[model samples]
Target: MSQPEHDAYAASPRTLEVEDLHVSVGDHLVAVSGVSFQLRRGEAVGLVGESGSGKTLTCRAVLGLLPETGEVDRGSIVLGESDDRVDLIAAGRTVWDRVRGSRIGAVFQDPGSYLNPGITVGRQLVEQLRVRGGLGRTEARERAVGLFTEVGLHDPAGVFQLYPHQLSGGMLQRVLIAIAISCEPELLIADEATTALDVVIQAEILELVARLRRDHELSLLLVTHDLAVVAETCDRILVMYGGEIVESGPTEQVLTDPRHPYTRALLAVATIGDWTRRTLDVIPGQPPSAGEEMPGCRFAPRCRYATQACVSAPVVTTEIGPGRSARCVRLDELDTEPGAVLVQDRIEATA
Candidate 1:
């Protein structure tokens, strides 16, 4: 197979910054706590973690698309460049309307859930064009057809007239991508956009996304659990566990030299081949429940190298390398291969 083509975007001063964000459902259950990250202009940052690790919540908080019951209690989500930076947490509906679909578009995990069954694809795309681009009906219709063609749809007019139900999963995903890039957003958030599709279709969607990012000069936040998927698409990786970022760095650096036990465990299972040729290496214990107060390291319960300090002391963000950080109390004592502890645990279990 040929290598994927890359497209570079023009340099810009804009960036998306999330600082000390805390999101909660109702009053008690905090879904995302003290999570902070930054995406520079035209950068693809992959947010990876198991489900319930607060990946989707962080994306929703940035877009101000959190459910009615969910609220941002602490921290600010700042967008745009230095002089014109706007805090999304304080932005009103009018501001969000102007920002979303225009400056910041999102492609959700499921197209069927977001796309209306009764509406024609053309009508939906035209609505976005009219609202975001302030175009007339004829102009919007023309733009919609162009978008359909751009996203690789065969018959623009035919696909435009069809309802959501009329298209296949891959087709619907392509339509969603078309809609997302309709207004040419500076930042595109794809939350598990290819999870539901088969392997072949997922590759196609990812390739399309790569092309779109280059052509449009868009910064992408790809939320996914598969480390391998992001390895192929993202520049940096942010590993989250128990609603907190446990480690983050350049994609290759983090994937090849993981410092946190949680990150190592996640990478161990995200493999195409298992050397053991037996049971796959799995992380023991479940994630803590939402709003559950963790006194020390959130992953200590399942960590083999965990000790008294890990169970009672605060897990400080240790600087493992330049621009790389890991939240683990025993970072200095950790071995190069963190998963070796898993092997030791199994041997002890069977002994």
Candidate 2:
């Protein structure tokens, strides 16, 4: 069957548009190339990919936390607001200092790595609350305690006094989340925020986030590879491959009826429908190094349907819905299925 064209995205009351964005790691490496998407208020958008697909980098760019070596080349992050469309990329440090943690909060992959081992957990939360969230010292401390309880922590006062090294990975993660969401920012970026936690903790965290977003009318940009997380938490999905978006649409649409070739393989491997009948599912080929420039579709080397057309086809997305799109050569003929042979059976190749 032919795939639906991009005009099919569901209607939403509010939106955050990211248009033609680019991120560079240095003089030569461009991590993400002209990426774009819309995130609605009180909704979740998942950018799905492996580590180097530029998911984290894109999130950091939004929060003004990109590494010194990394830079946002050009783009528009149109955050819906009462007045003034905030220009994140062109904003000054003073503007960023005001916006970063106050208007935008980030829950990164490693909470332990970010939390200061020397400081007590309570002190860190209180300080951030006072400085960014705009509470007095006493009020911030109380708010900190409130956040712990909100996140399902017991003995919140005792956990506050605990040092980073004294807590388990899950505890530290929850504490970090409390700090991130303490201010109730309009946007939240969760870059594998649940990675270190066990299954129970992960599920709890996801639920907590979903609840909070709905209650507070928050927008979330979730970067995760776990397909289940996408199914449960996100309304829409953006599939990233080799520093560009390969496919995106409503989560269900993209999952059940994928359009792009890369999207097809991802859905095949992740679909819950009939995985029981197949052996292990995997996508073949090591991703290309962004350090070197390549032409055409980046996933073409691994895509089963690739022909010569993909070799030089500049990466571009065809519209399938209001906010759904993808960069694939054979969008019309794409099919979601298990490969004839194991994707693993093939040798590693790059486009």
Models 1 onward score TM values of 0.90, 0.88
On TM-score, the leading prediction is: 1
**How many clashes in candidate 2?**
10
Off by over 4 Å in 2: 1-15, 271-280, 336-351
lDDT tens per residue, model 2, 1-351? 123333233344444678898888977488999888878778899999876888888887777788999987889776665574576666656787787777777887789999999999999999999888779988999999989888778899999899999998788888888888888788888999887788888998899899888877889999998877887899889999888998888787777667787766675566343334457768888787776567788888888888898987586778875566788778777644554322222212210
Cα lDDT for residue 336, candidate 1: 74
Per-residue lDDT tens digits of candidate 1, residues 1-351?
A: 011211122233557989999989867598888898888787899999988999998999889888888988899888888666888778767787779898898998789789989899889999989988899999999999999999999998999899999999999999999989998788999999999999899999999999998998889999998776887899889999888999998787787677898887886666532334466656778998789887899888888788988888667777676557899988888877634434324334555
Candidate 1 segments exceeding 4 Å error: 1-14, 272-281, 338-351
User: What is the lDDT of every predicted structure here?
Assistant: 0.84, 0.79
